[model samples]
Target: MRADSFFGKLTRTLTGDPGPTAPQSGGTRPKDLRRARLNDAVLAGESLVGALLTDAGMARANLSGADLTGADLSRARLPGANLARTTLVGARLVGADLKGAVLADAELTGAKLTGALLTNANLSDAELTDADLTEANLAGANLTSALLGRADLSGADLSDAYLTDGHLPNAKLRGVDLAGVNLTEAALVDADLTGASLTEANLGGADLTRADLSGADLTGAAVFEVRWTAGTRWPDREVEERLRALSQEVEPGVWTVVGDTGRSRGLRLGD
Candidate 1:
């Protein structure tokens, strides 16, 4: 049987459409029935992507491993839905409610997620390269090891998100909030972090070579073991001096004896 014909029949049956034409295999279902049902609903324009309903008000529907490439799912409510390993490439998910959704290993490249609420969503190992996440609320989302290369995250709120070992090369993060977020071992080469807040953020072992940090707040941020250059801004001269002094303060009197020996060290300031 043809794939489109099978899909059309399955969609009609799931949506209760009277024109549903049964196929030879008795409208054989996909491997994941719940995901196939959701995909069918999307194809029939009955439910949006990530929506938590089957036209019967079923809560917490599972759509794991569904292929929803290029689907329009604007303003859908999908809280606590299991979308693990789903393919949402180029899908329109503007303002979708995806709080607490498990999107691990999902492919959402080039998707539109503007103003979407993804709080506490598990996006670990997901591929979001080139996705438009402008103004999306990703607070507390676990994005560990996700690939977000070249993603446009302007004005996005990523506060407290766990991005350990994530690849974010060339990502646009202008005006994004990353306070208390852990970016350990993350790759941010050539990424723009202008005006972003890094307060108390842990960037241990992260490579930020050539990345822009202009006007970014790194106050109390833990940057131990991170590789950065003089191009990385330090807020003000006082803050830079403080950090330099702290580095030297670990060994007291180390710089004091640099100018003279033991006899000169005992001499007074005016003597």
Candidate 2:
């Protein structure tokens, strides 16, 4: 069909407008070709709730502030797309390619993003509470101050990712690779990090209350001023003793380690 016709259909569907529909004689084009057309036609701030945009090629498209709740965008290519503050609750983005996309402050609660490629993506301050990101590639991504409470990131690659002050309470990061990551002042309370790799990671002033680090690697990792409650599980007795030696009880069920620098590099524990 002509570009004009294709855009008209997309516009109607995106806007939820009622219009006359005509069945095409021939079958739709291949997913790649059709997706390219849709990509070219997707406008910013449009409502695409429950839209079926599977395998859409939306690289560099501007979709900021769009409502995409329950949308099926599995395997869609959206690298470099502007999706800031977008509503994507419960969206199916499994295997989607969102590398380098701007998703700051976006709502991704309960979204299925298994195997999605988010390398170098900017998701700072984004809400990913309860999101399923199993095996997602987030290497070199900026997730500073992002809320990942109860999120499942099992086996995900987060090497070189910036997660300073990020919230990951009760997060499941089993066997995930977090080597050399910066977790300064981040909250990882009650997080399950069993067997996860944290080699050379910076955990300065981070809260690890009740977090499980059994069988996890912390070789050469910076643990200065890190907060650990009595419920926190350590990898070994040797490491635990060393950490306790550096820490001091601040209050009931609260322990901290004072840092040898400016800025309150000390850890605190409560609730």
Against the true structure, what is every candidate's RMSD? 9.5, 6.1
Q: 153-243 in candidate 2: lDDT tens per residue?
A: 9999999999999999999999999998999999999999999999888898889999999999888777777889989888888777767
Worst 10 residues of 1 by lDDT: 250-259
How well does candidate 2 match the true structure in TM-score terms? 0.85
Error of 1 at 103 (Å): 0.6
Total clashing pairs in model 1: 0
Model 1: per-residue Cα lDDT over 1-106, one tens digit each: 4444545555557666555245446663332123233421323222233332212321255757767777666666777777777888888778878898888998
The most accurate candidate by lDDT is 2
